[model samples]
Target: MTAQSAHLDDELNLKALSFHAQPRPGKIGTLVTKPAATQQDLALAYTPGVAEPVRRIHTDPDLAYAYTNKGNLVAVITDGTAVLGLGNVGPLAGKPVMEGKAVLFKRFADIDCFDIEVQAETPEAFIETVVRIAPTFGGINLEDIAAPHCFEIEQALIDELDIPVFHDDQHGTAIILAAGLLNALELQGKTLEEAQIVILGAGAAGIASARLLLALGAHRDHLLCVDRQGVIHLGRPDLNPYKFGVAVETNKRTLTEAMQGADVFIGLSGPDLVTPEMIASMAPRPIVFALSNPVPEIRPAAALAVRSDLVMATGRSDYPNQVNNVLGFPFIFRGALDVRASRINQAMRIAAVEALRDLAREPVPQAVLDAYGLNALSFGPDYIIPKPFDPRLRERVAGAVAQTAIASGVARLPLSD
Candidate 1:
């Protein structure tokens, strides 16, 4: 790092510490939505009047939606095994991220959230903890859990509970990625079925992205998933079930080999793992989403220096095409909560993908342009995904998800307006 960049990093670190410390040391808190100043309000909020709703709900369990916060509340649960780029920080340290997720939900979707950190010794224990408390909220946003275990926990929760359970690291990344990739392919005059896609990092995000891409019509044979051990081919004996799910029959055994003549490169691995040689080896007009955070696999400047025909994206706000999960999760949960969806099904995910993909093709709003300090942006190489600050995302993505849930018969309530 340069002296200037080092100084900037120091400044950001100090500012972040101060920001988190000054505001009473946390990012979220509960707020009373009802009047509570009088004795009658107390009686209605807690004792006598609350008993009526309790009785009604005891007779018919669905009345909890009408009588309590269950209709619009989400539980942001985490075990801290995979907190951001920092791994295994534990539940106490993971609280801040969960709270940050709650802030985004409220900021973007007007939804209420309770951040829950579980101190469980095993994955089964964590699953039980969340299942026991599942009735308190409309949906669950599983955050910061490690792979393989995360996949198991989320699946168990979805099967056991009658609410949406989403692991944001997995599906949120996949949704935004698919949306951007679709637009990028269109601009490059290619198609998902024909593109040679290589996904580096066979963890949660990489595997999920591969699955969603296949669902969106990408040929399974055209995709390759690589990890620390190289390509996850069919002959690998140590592959987990999740990694094995996306394993293809390929002769390639390394990331360098996998990138040869590839049309798309998705990096969920650590920073600087991709070289300029790898970028140069890809097919013409290749689309690359170097999505590792704080730093990408290959910096945009370095990647662009090699191939100007590349369509690049990162998980950074400073970049032109940022694949942020905030663009998907808030609105997705909003729609699921609004319609009382039984689960966040594949149809709902595809609906979100299409909504985000279609939104980018539309005219960029002035407010969004101002937010980014850009005079204009259009659907092209540099702007393949919708900006997070775009106000249309809430209505557009949420409405599509809710409608798809209803059509797919997983929604218990009809959409209002």
Candidate 2:
């Protein structure tokens, strides 16, 4: 790195440290929602009046939603195995990230969250802990656990808990990706069923994206997943069950080979793993979502320089068409909580995808434009996904998800409007 860029990085690190430190030791704390100032109020809040509601809740368990904060609360739980790019930092080190997620839950959707960091030796131990405490909140948001284990933990929680259990690292990434990919394909005059798509990662986000894409009608044979072992095809002997799910009988054995004549490329791997040659080798009007953060697999400038017909996106906010998790998780939880949904099922996820995809096609609102300091943005090659600050996101995505949940028979309560 240049001296100037290195200096900037140091400055940013200091600023971020101060931002989290000076305001308080951490980013989040609880606020009491009920009055407890006066003697009478204390009696009502704790002993006498609280006992009446406790009795009602004991008689009818659903009454807890009416008497407490359970309807609006979520637990953001993590084991720190895959905390951002800093993998396996441990539970305590991962606390800041979980708290940041809580901040987003409140800021974006007005949902309350308690960030819980678990120190469990085994996946089964962690699962048992969450299952034991599942009654306190309306929903659960699993974060930052590493793959294979993450897949197992999430499925177990979903099966055991009645409330929605979501791993944002997996489904949140998939939901936004699907929305952006659908729009990009439409602009390129391609369809998901026929697009030759290559995803260069086999971890949680990569595997989940593959599954959601398949559910959305991408032909299984048309998709390829590449890990460190190169392309995960049927011939690979070391494939795990998750990798095996997306594995196909293809002669392509490497990322370069997989990219040949491909219609789309999605990189969830580390920086600079993709080359200009790979970008150039793709079909005309290629869609490239190099979604690795801080640095993409191929830098946007380099990729665009290679192919002007490219429709590119990354996980960076400075770039147009950012495929961000912030655009999905908050609103998704909002919708699920509103209807007391049993789970965040496939139909609800597809509804969120369609909501986001369709929203991008509309005219960009002035508020959103102002938030990004852009004079205008239109739905096209450069702008394939809705901006994170788009106010309509809560109503559009959340409403669709809630309605779909009710229609799909997963909701415990009907939406009043």
Tell me each candidate's TM-score: 0.99, 0.99
lDDT at residue 68 of model 1 (Cα atoms): 94
**lDDT of candidate 1 vs native?**
0.95
TM-score, candidate number 2 = 0.99
lDDT of 2 by residue, 1-417 (tens): 579979998999999999999867899888998787899999999887789999999999999999999999999999999998888999999999999999999999999999999999899999999999999999999999999999999999999999999999999999999999999999999999999999998899999999999999999999999999999989888988999989999898989999999999998878999999999999999999999987899999999999999899999988889999999999999999999999999999999999999999999999998998989899998899999889999999999999999999999888876
lDDT for each of the candidates?
0.95, 0.95
- Give per-residue CA lDDT, model 1, range 152-232, as digits (tens): 999999999999999999999999999999999999999999999999998889889999999999999999999999999
The C-alpha stretches of model 2 lying farther than 4 A from their native spots are none
Clashing pairs for model 2 are: none
RMSD of 1: 0.8
Candidate 1 ranges with C-alpha deviation above 4 Å: none
